[model samples]
Target: MIRVFGMHNIQPLLNKVYPKATTANGVYIYDEYGKAYLDGSSGAVTCSLGHSHPRLIPYIKQQLDKLQFVYRSQFGSEEAEQLATRLFEHSPERIYAHSFFVNSGTEAIETAMKTAVQYWQEKGFPSKQQFITRWKSYHGITVGALSLSGHPLRRQRFESTLEKYPRLKADLENDTLEKLTEEFVQVIESIGANHIAAFVAEPIVGAAGTALTPQAGYYQEMKKVCEHYQILFITDEVMTGLGRTGTWFGIEHWNTTADIVAIGKSLGAGYAPIAATLMTDEILEPIKNGSGLIMSGHTYSGHPLSCATANRVLEIIEEEQLLDNVNTQGEYIKQQLNVLKENYPVIQHVRGKGLMLGVEFDPARKGFQQKLIERCFQNGLLVYPSVGGPEGKDENGILVSPPFIISRSEADELLAKLDQSLNEINQ
Candidate 1:
């Protein structure tokens, strides 16, 4: 008998042998040996519906049998049209009037970047091409997205090839809204707003900032500045979109809207690979009147199967009223985390909205984040690593964003496992 070895994948760790997941159901992933691992971070905060969801399987199978692949320019699919309509209906009113589907978060961001540039071009300002971004953000992995992002580590290797976009080192958490808005005006003036196309930022900073959330009036003030300069405002909601933050859109928490929005992660709910670039009618109107086309898409931009899978995912979220569960269980988890923070000096801060929570460790105790992650893994729990500290480069944080469908009992179990992991690391 001949044994065949499958091709090896280039994972984050090359020298380590990670456990092999054979099956997964709900919030737990089972290894080949039948050991179950709780999905604490929802697979990098993407799996909002958990694993092997029974409801999703039949829907996917049905869609697979009906229609799957289709070229974007060749034809149109109701799956894509309906998904776009659903996203607009759920978004903040007067916010999203159209959606451009893509294969990944990075593609959605790249598409958004192009759309913003084109929006300015159609308005007869071709010099409006530069973008302004904060230092504590991770937009995407593509070249164009990477150029706009301020994530130091992710941009290190590609620095030479990336564009020299201005990265404002403004403190969203500590600075007053007035100071923040002033800083924005200063940068816009310095760069000459006519040369800038958009100001891009994450609604709540995700992996790069450890779910760092700004003050109540932050977005409102910032949006005002962008409008004053005639610059577009784009929010990267890849991690917080589709009810992850207890709202249809994370920016809705502040009652602010962006000119362009990028949504992914939970849109497919771990069942498919999909993302989208959403824009307001004001954004599309100028381009539609001038160029008659926005000029962004991929061969599989609107893959029918992926669209169907994502559409059903949204339907289930609406059907089950999962946003309510996210709020209820998120508060319970947040309250429990605060108690843990009181007991443990290592847990310096806890912040974020709904289920998209983050725990920042004391910077003085370096590498404590990885220690806790390994401990959590040993205890059959999982968590996503994040960066924190003044510069936002230190990996001293962890995000605890789990699936939205998590129940109170499951929340207790997750908290217990996390508590145990923290205790072990403290020892």
Candidate 2:
């Protein structure tokens, strides 16, 4: 097996072990051998519109015929502007007046953090630099984003290197809503409000586990606390945005908004590498009014080709009314998963919102997760196990997020395969 450093020395699947040549469409992936597997998890909750959508190719071709690349530093392109405008239409106007495009989710997160710090500095609170993130969260693999992530296994080796930023673990399980809010507030207070730039979190914790939705009124309370201390609220919606949770933004479920919103994964609908960090006018005012420049720039910051592709995706999503499909199908999947939980002794929990679903196994059932994955694979299904759990143990769960384009028949097929896989595990 080959191992290579991915996003800060994290061991990613190497070419030797995970050989390339593949074909995929909708919710099915095929290897070079022509063995097809149902993409149960949508390739880590990406491919939301499914792989190789017919419309994306023509859109990309059209952009290529016109202009493939343009420097967004000094110039503005119609594609980029149009995509930004569409994104804002879906999100809260107060949360996303200005956007900075990047290549991936981690890049978006890193940009959000830096933007928060810069906004504070521009507001004459240069001391506000530290950030607070919750435990068991996956923000991405970039160093800056990793510093804000709380996934234990992902950060175990990098802790020594990330000591500059103070880390505070918010209780995700034990603490009551008020207690958790107070704990988070105390952490910021201890670091001094003037020194804490932002508090970042996933409104519906995606990678850690499907829709680990916060306690009642938790986020609303947290927002109030941040407002009181003048701290920026940054919501990492890489997996939960784009109508994944029955809403344009998952934070809407709590009736709250963030100062900055990091969105990706589904934005391009697997057609392009595009991610963005959105901020309110308040957050961008200082920089716009002062230097009129953001300190960050990337070679492909707003690549025209990517923007064009993403814009087409946005159009398709709207024209197809996929958000309605997401809500309807998401509710169906949740109900079915709940039925499974009731039937299986090993199934401990069924959680998530919209299409993002998780099925946690009993911790006492050793090797259950691996057994489940192997069974699913043998049955021509593809699913992703939760990251950062006890090795060789059933300490984690599995994600079951298919594309929004999936139909009723496809959903039935997935459920049948899942039932068979679960039965095999029970035996």
Best model number under TM-score = 1
lDDT per residue as tens, model 2, 1-427: 5654433332365332442338988888888788888888888787888888887787788789998888886688998898888887787644587789998999999999989988888888888888887766779987888888867667778878763555445555447887887787788778888888998999877766445667668889989999999989999999998877878898998898999999999888777899999988899999888777788868999998998888888788888999899888988988998899988978877878888887888877777887888889879888878742333122468888888888888888888899999997798
**Runs in model 2 lying further than 4 Å from the true structure:** 1-16, 19-21, 164-174, 387-395
**TM-score for model 1?**
0.98
lDDT of 2 at 203: 88
Candidate 1 yields a Cα-based lDDT of 0.91
Residue 263's C-alpha lDDT in candidate 1?
A: 91
Query: Residue 276 of candidate 2: its Cα lDDT?
Result: 94
Tens digit per residue, CA lDDT, model 1, 159-225: 9999999888879899888888888899989989999999999999999988899999899988888
Worst 10 residues of 2 by lDDT: 387-396
Q: Evaluate all candidate structures by whole-model CA lDDT and list the values in order.
A: 0.91, 0.82
